[model samples]
Target: MHITLIVPTNGRPSLVSRLLAHLERQTLHPDHVIVSATTPNDIEVRPDISFKVSYVFGDPGLCAQRNRAMALCDGTTDIISFFDDDFVPCDSYLETLSRVFREHPVYAVVTGDLLADGAQGPGLGFDEAVAMLDAYRPSSLPAHVRDHPGAYGCNMSIRAQVIGDLRFDERLPLYGWQEDIDFTSQLRAHGRIVNIGQLWGVHLGAKGGRVNGVRLGYSQIVNPIYLIGKGTMQRWFGIRLICRNLVANTLKSLRPEPYIDRRGRLKGNMIGFAHVLTRRADPEHILKL
Candidate 1:
C-alpha cells in the first residue's frame, strides 16, 4: 500500500523537523510526506531524509493547512495519514495500519491508541515522549478494533478513494477544534471508522504552537454547536461536550493549573455563550481574537 503522510503545523519549525526525522525511522516508511504550514518559517526542510518530503505553505489554520496538503495527493496514493507535528508513533505504526486496512476492507478510516497523550494534561517534552515510545513493546494480543464516531486528529488515516470529494471544514479555523469528528462523520457513509489498538502513538501536545486560551475555549463551545447544526454532530453529544468544557473551565479557574490558562478559557466560554444567544456564534470568529 502506498501511504502518504500529511502533517499540518505552525510556529514550530524545529518540532516539525524532529517529526520528519522520526518518520525516516518508521518500519514501513510513508511513500511520501507533505508538511503544510502557514509560512516557510513554520517548517525547516531537511533534504537528507530518505523518504520524500514536500513542504508547502497555506493559509494559517489547521483545517486549511490540511486541505491544502490533501490537494497534493495523486492517483497512486492508497491511504492518507495525518499526524500532528508533536505526535510520535511507534516504529511499526505505518506497518500496522497497512496490515489492518488489508485485513479489514470495511474500514474507511483508522485512528490509533495513544500511549501517552499530553493534551489531556500538561504537555510532554520531546525527549520524554521518545523515551516512552522506546521503552514500549507491541502487545502480543491481537489488535483490538472499536467503532468510533470520528478519528482522532493526532494520528489517523483514511482510504484515499473514500475521501474523493470531502475536505476539512475551513471554518473551524486554527486548531480546527473537533475537525476530526466533522470530517469523519462525512466519511462514515463511505465506510467504517475504527480505532485499531496496534496502530498507536504518543501525542506530545506541545504547548508552544497552540491557539490562545480564549480562542480555544471559544472554539470548544462554538465549534461543537456549529457541527451539530450542520448535522455532523448529534445535538445531545454537542450539548454534553459544551457543558463539560464550560463547567471544567469554570471550576478549574478557581484554582487553575500552572500549565493551563483556566481563567482565560472561562472568559472565552462566556463569550461563546453570549454569541450563541445572539445567533452570532461562528467558528471563524476565532480569527478575530
Candidate 2:
C-alpha cells in the first residue's frame, strides 16, 4: 500500500516547510512525496526524510502543477494524497486516509473534515456567515458525506486506478477557486465520492484578502453558469435565477465586509456580466483575496 503525496506550491516557503514537517511525522509514511513549485529554485527539501522527494518546477496554473506532480507519482503508486501547501497534517492522516480507502476501494474519491482552525469562538463577526456557508456542506462522517465525488482538493486521496482517466481541468482560467468543485463534479459522474471521517485535515484558513471584501461571484456565479452551459448540472439554472442567487449571496457575504459597497456590488456585477457576454470577460481574472 504505497501512497503518493502530491503537494503544489507557488513559492511559499513557510507553508511548504510546515507541510513537509507534518508529512515527515505521518504515522503511515507515503511511498513517495512530490512537490511542484512554480519556479525551479523553490525546491529546498531536507535530504534526511525517509521517503522519496521529487520536484517539478515552472508549471504555472493550478491544474498544470497538479498534473505534473501526478505524473511523478508514477504508475506503481497506489494512492495519491493531494494537499494544499497550507495544510499541516496530523500524525494519523495517512494511516486513517489509507485505511478508509483500503476498506472502501470502490469509491472514486474521499475527503475528510477540513476543520477551520483559529479564532474558533462564536464571537467573530464572520462566525455566522461561515456557519451559513458550511451548514449545507456535505460532511464525511461515514454516516453522511460518504457517497459523493464532491470533495475538497486539499487533504483528499484517490486510488491510482480511479484517477487514471481523470485529470484536473487545466482550461480553467485562474490558479485558485472553483476548479476543485468542477473536478470533483466530473469525478462524481464517473464514481462515488465519500467523506472518510477517521481522517481529518485542518485548514490554516487564509482567504488571502477576500475576507475584507465580499467575493461577489465565481464559485457563486460564473462556474455554475459554465457547468450549466456544459450541461453538467442535473437541472437548468437560468441566467435570471443565477443572478438572483449571486445577488443574495453577495448580500450575505457583504454583511461582514466593509470594503464592498452593496449598491456598487450589484452594479459591478451587472457591468461584469456585460463583459462576460461580450466575450471580454474571463472568470479566472476575478479578484481574490
Q: Which candidate should be chosen as best, given TM-score against the real structure?
A: 1
- Candidate 2, residues 58-81, lDDT tens digits: the string is 656667888888866667877888
lDDT (10s digit) by residue, model 1, range 43-129: 887878998889889678888999999989999999999999999998899998988888888999999999999998899988898
Model 2, residue 250: distance off in Å is 3.5
Candidate 2, clashing residue pairs?
148-193, 208-289, 209-289, 210-289
All predictions: root-mean-square deviation over Cα?
A: 1.0, 6.2
TM-score of each: 0.97, 0.74
Q: What is candidate 1's TM-score against the reference?
A: 0.97
> What's the true lDDT of residue 258 in model 1?
85
Full-model lDDT for every candidate: 0.91, 0.62
Model 2 vs truth, CA RMSD: 6.2
- The reply for model 2, stretches above 4 Å from the true place, is 41-43, 117-145, 207-220, 233-249, 252-272, 276-281, 284-289
